[model samples]
Target: MAHVDSIRKDMVILEKSEFANLRTENEKMKIELDQVKQQLVNETYRIRADSKLAINLERSRVRVTDMFTDQEKQLMETTTEFTRKDTQTKSIISETSNKIDTEIAYLKTLMESNVLETVCNLAASVFTCLQ
Candidate 1:
């Protein structure tokens, strides 16, 4: 009976030691879980901030693109207007030049006719004098 009591006591002590080890392991696991939770929170915050920044950057890019598109449209319109005006001016100049050329030709024809009439009168006068 005495030997049996000693063996039971030894078993109890071993079980207690194992319980303590399990408790220590549980405490370590708790600490590790807390660290993991903290890391997850930090990562979540960083991801949210990065997402917001990306959204803002995208909005800015869209605004700049819209502005450029508007400017390009305006420039194209201005260029088209300038081309239209330039073509109109060139057409007016060409029409005026043609009218001037026509007037000059008419004046040259009148001068030639007057010169021929003068020569015929001088010949008639000379012929009368000879007679």
Candidate 2:
């Protein structure tokens, strides 16, 4: 009977040790689960922030593109206006040049006619005086 009781006591001690080890493993598993949950929360926050930033970046890009498009349109309009003005100025200059040429030719004819009339009158007076 004494030997049987000692064997029973040894069995009891082994059971307690096994129970303690199981409890320690359970605690470790719980801690690992908590860390995983925290990491998931942090990743979710980062994803949300990145999504907001991406939206803002897209908006800014659109605004800048619109501005560039407007500038391109304005530049095209300015170029067209400059070309029209240049054409008008060239036409005016050509018309003014034609007018100046006409006036110069008329003045030259008038001076030549006056000189010939004066020479003829002098010749007639000399002929009459000789007679």
Candidate 3:
């Protein structure tokens, strides 16, 4: 009976040690799981921030493209208006030059006609006096 009691006591001690070791291992695994959870949360937060930044960048790109398109339209309109004004100015200058040329030609013709009439009258007077 004494021998049986000693064997039973030894078995109990060995079972308790095994239970303690299992508890320790379970605690370590729980700590590791908590660290892994925190890492996952941080990574998720970083991904969300990156997603927001990408959305803002896409919106900015769209806005800039719209602005550039509007500016290009305005530039085209301004260029068309400038072209029209330039054409009108050229027409006015051409008309003015033509009018001046016509007036100069008419005045030269009048001057030549007057000189010929004066010469004819002087020749007639000299012929009559000589006769």
The root-mean-square deviation over C-alpha atoms between each candidate and the true structure, in angstroms, is 56.1, 56.8, 56.8
TM for every model, in the order presented, reads 0.45, 0.46, 0.46
Best-matching candidate per TM-score: 3
lDDT of 1 by residue, 1-131 (tens): 35544755665576567556755665675576566556655655665566556556666777677756665565566556556655665675566556656755764575466457545655766686689
lDDT values for all models: 0.60, 0.58, 0.60
Question: What tens digits encode model 2's per-residue C-alpha lDDT throughout 50-109?
Answer: 655655665677767775666556556555655565566557556655665664565457
Instruction: After the best TM-score superposition of candidate 2, give how far the Cα of residue 48 lies from its true spot, in angstroms.
Output: 46
List, in order, the clash count of every candidate structure: 0, 0, 0
Kindly report which residue stretches of model 3 are placed more than 4 angstroms away from their true locations once superposed: 1-63
lDDT of 3 by residue, 28-108 (tens): 755765665566556555655665565566566776777566655655665565566556656755665566567557655
Better of 1 and 3 by TM-score: 3
lDDT of 2 at 59: 61
Who is ahead in lDDT, 2 or 3? Answer: 3
In model 1, which regions exceed 4 Å deviation? 1-63, 128-131
